[model samples]
Target: MSALRAPASPGTRPAAAPRRAPLTSLPGGAADRGRRLDAVRAPLQATSGVPFLVLCAVILAGALLAALLLNTSMARGSYEASRLQAEVGHVAQDVQSHQEKLRAAEASLAERATRLGMVPAEDPTMISIEKRAKVGVGEADAGADATLGP
Candidate 1:
């Protein structure tokens, strides 16, 4: 059987349009120069996703670095606080030791007074004077006189 070609209708269309040369291929003109300049600046004009991602990455990195620095500063402060607490504890221990030594010294002074023939009086005498009084104004007792050395 012979293959028959179909007749073209009045409104039939071609398979494809004719290819034309780009505008830049033509002679130099304002429009062509503009197109050339646009071509040159197109890459710069159209933003790429990489720059956005890079900006986000930079911001994230900066935030992380700031957090790290803040945490480091806080850790240093904690360390300093711990050191100060330890120092306070050591100072408190020293104060306690000094207080104990003072108590011992006071006891030793009391013992030394007793050894030096000083007796603690059971009844303490108080003589109040509004103005200066003459020496030996208080009444003398035999026990007081006996306590004094001859």
Candidate 2:
């Protein structure tokens, strides 16, 4: 049987060993201790509230500025409206003054015509330019009009 022991198969290949990560520093530079090392990290620091406060302040200032501009615009518009109302009142006064003057002038004209002995014609006559003749005899006066009393 020792002589009959099977020879190693020539057709079979040997399996490769599993790959492993190389060890870095371990206390005294120990190798292959089979322990994973923890990674070092930066320490946590406290953040300041100044940047947030500044942002809030800027937004508040912008809102105030917008409100100021809106108020100014409203005030300007109010001033313009008041000015236009005053101008309208002035125009109305001017128109009324002109109307009063016209009335006075009309009355003056009537009185002047009476003083100049210009009387209203009872039987009005017209010379027709187109026909080149007198339109009527015009000798009769107010007798045919029923509205006139004898």
Candidate 3:
């Protein structure tokens, strides 16, 4: 019903939308402080050419890149560690196999020596030396020959 109301007749011309209210300076009230804040924010808004959403996107992209780089480095280190561990395992297996072969060889040598009438000598001090004087050169004394049996 006031001057700002729209026309009721649809057949007539369409009424224009009301103009926005003018900017007004307010007192030191909270609403006035809010307007003052807006007034102070205007220059910052004008100077900040980049939009907030775009800046956030750029920051997110940088963080993602850094994360990706760190992930790649960690993956490479993990692979290297796995490879070294495998190598160590392989070397350990080789050492075990070699030790087994050495034991088998020592056993075989002892068996062959026993077959050929070779035996480990007893304590040299326990043998009597009197028989050594009677035995000719290149001939083993009777006491020494008795000690040589398997």
Which digits, one per residue and each the tens of the lDDT, describe model 3 over residues 44-93?
Answer: 33556568879999999999999999999999999999999999999999
Flag regions of model 1 displaced more than 4 Å: 1-44, 114-150
Runs in model 2 with CA error above 4 Å?
Answer: 1-40, 43-51, 113-150
How many Å off is the CA of 111 in candidate 2? 3.1
What candidate 3 gets wrong by more than 4 Å, as runs, is 1-45, 49-58, 112-119, 124-150
User: TM-score for all predictions?
Assistant: 0.46, 0.44, 0.43
Candidate 3 weakest lDDT stretch, 10 residues = 133-142
User: In what order do the candidates fall by TM-score, top score first?
Assistant: 1, 2, 3
RMSD to truth, every model: 13.4, 20.7, 13.4
lDDT of 2 by residue, 80-142 (tens): 999999999999999999999999999899789999999877777665666655565366733
C-alpha RMSD in Å of predicted model 2 compared with the true structure: 20.7
Which residue pairs of candidate 3 clash?
none
lDDT of 1: 0.74
Whole-model alpha-carbon lDDT for candidate 2: 0.78
Candidate 3: RMSD to truth: 13.4
The model with the greatest lDDT is 2
